[model samples]
Target: TDQVQEVLEAAGKVYTVLKIDEVSNLGAARIRVRSLLAALKDQADREAEAAADAAAEKRGCPAACIDLNNLDKLVPASFTEKADGVVAAAEVEQREGASTEFERVQFTEEMRDAGYTILAPQMAPYHFELLVPIFKRAGYNAVLLPSVDHGAVDAGLKYVNNDICYPSILVTGQIMEAVLSGKYDTDKLAVLITQTGGGCRATNYISLIRKALKSVGLGHIPVIAISFKDLGEDNPGFKITPKMLYQAIYALQYGDLLMMCLYRTRPYEVEPGSANRLFDYWMDACKHQLQRGVRQSEFRRTVRRIVEDFDTLPLAGEGTKPRVGVVGEILVKFHPTANNQIVDVIEREGCEAVVPGLIEFFLFGIAGGIFQQPIGKSKKSALGSRIGLAAVKKLRKPVNDALEKSARFHPPADIYELAEYAEEILSLCNSMGEGWLLTAEMVELIRSGCPNVVCTQPFACLPNHVVGKATIKELRRRYPESNIVAVDYDPGASEVNQLNRIKLMIAVAKANLAEKEAEARAARDAARDGAPEDPEPVAEAVEVETTEVAE
Candidate 1:
């Protein structure tokens, strides 16, 4: 009886806190109740839609928002062939299928033989799930193991002596969580860590991982340091097989294509899960084709077929819309972590959401270095410039090709001019780091027809806060009618708060678009300008905030 009383007390308090209706009149109270019920109904509908999308994703069709079916095979067979050596090593380990100790010894030996260079903070498109595919495509026989999570964070808290970055903790936590999940075998498993050799405590992440292994009594496992600093592996040499590179690049290209398709289709889908269903089918097809050695010509043919297939999807939305561009920190902008599904929110609001590919992040990072060093073009700096430019062209070529071939989808001009357009922006925002670059990108997005830009970033991320917050004023000043908003994510933030902010931003964007169209109409009448009239106003957008945090 006492326990029941206690439970009732708790429930009552909860209801009291949530029931914020302070209407003084019966009419006001009725309106408030009706609005609340309507909001609840809308939420339930969205949940049902998401659930339907998830189901469609499971059914091996395209995801309602994205498709991966037909991407140009970005990585050629040659790259996979080159990665054969690495695969051979992993095969040997599996074949030896020996005890954990033996496998560890073998792995160590292989690492030393190939001179496995660990890239510090070695982050990639596919962290763990896609590592095998990436390695296979890259023609490398490498295994990516999650490093110490809790241990690394604890170590960082102790010795690294730096303000804790959320990524570091999340990465660590993800590893730790995976470890505890018992899905991974720590034995014979060598976790790869990147040591940047920089001032950032990020350099210590590897050491922390090592320490973590020891603390967890998993010290026997090898810690492979993937670095660009010519770090030597004594136990074994590490080599990249051509195949792994091919798979890695292909996977990323496919990911990009999928992202692009999803963004394009989502804004006006009739059936909620249609885009996602196609994505699943496309992934399965890509995997199968890669395994079967599909002909290059056939590959293009397959993509065309898939695009035709997607185009045939009967899904339709309510209205014509303005496409908005979303650009910001890579994780926040793309990951639900930072933006709380801002892209989806924008789409739901009856607008096309354009998110640039991950390649731009890489391009910006490289360009940042060159701009930072004025002497980059000198004889001594010639090698760096050559390398940077080569990388830019190499990475950009496929993207450019994809865009060129895309009939239904056209990437914004800013994306085509990414490397070239980034130069001046880099110079102007050097003080703000990559955040400033992201802001500039968002600004460029607005300038290039995406009247609305949303900068998704972590709350209190110094670079992001400075760049995102400060650049808004400049963006609006330059593009007076620009609709811009920065959504911040942190552990304790409420979904309601986040959604409310985004809704407000979208409202402003809608208002601005309306005013612009009105002005254009007025101008059209005055000048008899043969220009076409403006697009009509869209229905109010439905904004939902559901950003997932590591916790």
Candidate 2:
């Protein structure tokens, strides 16, 4: 154990030490040790190359010769020549004292008194819509921008690089369109966007928004970064107190519950708009409670009531619709506009949509920290990761309990359980945008009675490609009855093509449902005829796997 520890320490790595006595076979142990050494050598080579590239870049030589870290920077020198005109125009603007520094909006008492409205881009309708009032109760004037339309997408493409992820385009476009619409006074307006401050390009969205604003002559409007970390510390007035954080957490939980209930009840509601009307009612009520400052006990009681209200809705239809789960990149999975209103399309195709709750994403993010520690080389990171996992788990308990009380809703699996499930196929170190969480969500969906899934993602998102689309085969092998399809959404992707693919998935889902129903009928007949209560197990439903790539 001491020798192994020394070897690992020399390699600048860490591992759980096992005693030599624990190895039952010396030959097997030797082989495992050799494999570990090989992996360490590969890691060391990569690090040495990265260091060399950094040294070269520091000496003003292009890092591209040694490292392909950033694909965007790998363009040909001719691309730079082509950009000269744009650069020259920008330089002229710069000379005119055009501010390059991204302005941060401080949520001070003065700004609040002046009624400065903070505009946030809408991702999930119920979540964002309810979040507005939560911000208001916490003493900030906040509003979620309206749903993204064709105009928003067009406006987004105008300001943002089309090659970037679709979610960023829509978000940036929505804020830009809102500013350009001249609907609000520019002086009193500020745009709020979340910064993950991580490897994901989403952290740079604030910079993108600032540049877009500068280009559109809206740079005077402050851009506030909404992040839990110090990334958004430029605005000291936007204090996230413990109380405010508590309320916000509950708000998210409630939003997810409401969304779940809405999706479940909407398709079968006797009245066309009954579920929507109730949804609106709860939105208003939740907002009112937020304004009054809801207590923890009060929130718990309120959630139960909210669930009961939705449960009471008249669902007069057949109620046996094919259930389909939606999973993918966070924005594309939840944002209706980004995916061209896919949930509605699923319903139109005679299926009930089951969107995994937003809270699971939060849990997945927290649990990712715990997983990172085992493979991570840094001690500080490991410690911080452990602390973060514990803190989030503590916060998650109440929300998890509330979700459990909502009888009709399928409570999300524990974060550790999700990580365990994901580990069976994906490595925990595969932490990127969505990462292992995307794969885990698919597994969760299949486990939680929704076997048919639609994995929505931006066209060619590498992380999703690795962890999402790539994991489907393994998932199908494990859950043979599972039917999954990957749908790519992009600016040029046709709605007709997307829907046609989904229609086929729905066709398979209907057949699977029919088969299951037939098996159930057969079992019932056997029981009635005084035969064996347990009939022979039904054969596995044929899997329908398809990848719908956007043109």
Candidate 3:
């Protein structure tokens, strides 16, 4: 055991497990091993960064004053004047000699109190619309950038490297396009992006945006990166507080529940916008609840009300529409513009669009630490992850419970169960971009009576290309009735080609629905006539139709 441990240590591998029962007392050892690993990794980096790294370790977001007396004379009246909760604005000074980790941008501590117009690219519209309000309540003035146009893509192509995934291009494009459009004050502008800190190229998106900004002579604009990993002191003023994190989690739960309910009832509403009207009402209500700083009880009540409101949408004459599940890379799957309005496309084809909740993607990420337990550096880190996951699941209980109780809705609740399901096909440790989660979502979608699915992939996303498009045949083999179409989204991807593929999938789904209905009718008739129902003949007609659609 000592020799093995020595060998493992030499390889820079972590093994915290000894006796299994030792894991039972995490409170006794709450130290974070991941930080130690990060420190080691940082030290091994280029020696030129040594001084900057040392200064960063000791740096902190300073307590700053916010008053019109310190503010610029030309500052806008609404911004300079004190708001209900915020202090009067102060002049945010550009700091000298900050670590230009990305490029030549310097973000000072004063920006935290300055309330810069944070332009965050809209990923999930429903989620962000609900979420940004919570962020505002947490003291960050965040705005979800409106969907990008052709100009946005063109801007991205001109500024950002064209070789990356479609999402990066689109995201960069939106930010740059917004900046170039002169809609906001350039001096008081910032861009917010999430960094997963994973092996995927997405970890470097902040740097890409910074580089793009530098290329456009706007390098002074701070790129505020939202990362769970601690980026040392030479950074932006924005940081995630515990309260902010808590509020954000609830916001996401609301987003997921709302999204699930909206898609569930929208396609079947008697009035065209009945479901949307309900959604709009609930959105404001939930946003208010989050803004006012409610406890879990209020959140639970709000969820129940949300579900109840959506339930009242008065569904149209629906024997049943073929439900199409949309699962893919986080951005493209949720952002309508990114995937050429995929949910709308599915809805237009007379199908219920079932997008698995955003919370599930977050769960997959949180579970990654726990997934690494076997080879994890410290049992405490694994314990922390498990505890975090459990807490999130606990917070999510109300949303799931509300969803499950509703006659009109039922969304997936358990991440562990999902892991177990996905483990059948691929190892959970293979956590890259989407990785096993994509395959798992497709599986869950099919198993939950929604067999028709659309897997959206960014044209150049290698991880998704492997896990999503590559897993389709195997998924079909497992669930023979599943009608799946993988659509790739790129700056130059053909919408017509995508539509044709989707139309083909929908045709198959329609044929499958027809066969099932015929089988049911035949069963009823055979029972009345005291004869066994023959479903094979019923299947033949649909099969012929499917072949024609294929052709």
Best by TM-score: 3
- Candidate 3: worst-modelled 10 consecutive residues by lDDT: 87-96
lDDT per residue as tens, model 2, 288-353: 887777787777677777777886788875459999999998888888788889889999988899
Better of 1 and 2 by TM-score: 2
Q: How high is each candidate's TM-score?
A: 0.61, 0.74, 0.76
Instruction: Assess the local accuracy of residue 549 in candidate 3 as a C-alpha lDDT between 0 and 100.
Output: 100
The segments of candidate 2 whose C-alpha lies over 4 angstroms from its true place after superposition are: 1-112, 316-319, 375-407, 531-551
Residues 221-326, candidate 3: write the lDDT tens digits. 9888887765542464666778878988988888888888888888888888988888888888888887876689999888888888887768886548888899
What C-alpha lDDT values do all the predictions have?
Answer: 0.54, 0.78, 0.79
User: What's the CA error at residue 410 for candidate 2, in Å?
Assistant: 3.1
Error of 2 at 458 (Å): 1.1
Q: How much RMSD separates candidate 3 from the native structure?
A: 21.0
User: What are the clashing pairs of model 3?
Assistant: none
lDDT (10s digit) by residue, model 1, range 424-469: 3334334343534576677667766776777766544566666676
Question: Rank by TM-score, descending?
Answer: 3, 2, 1
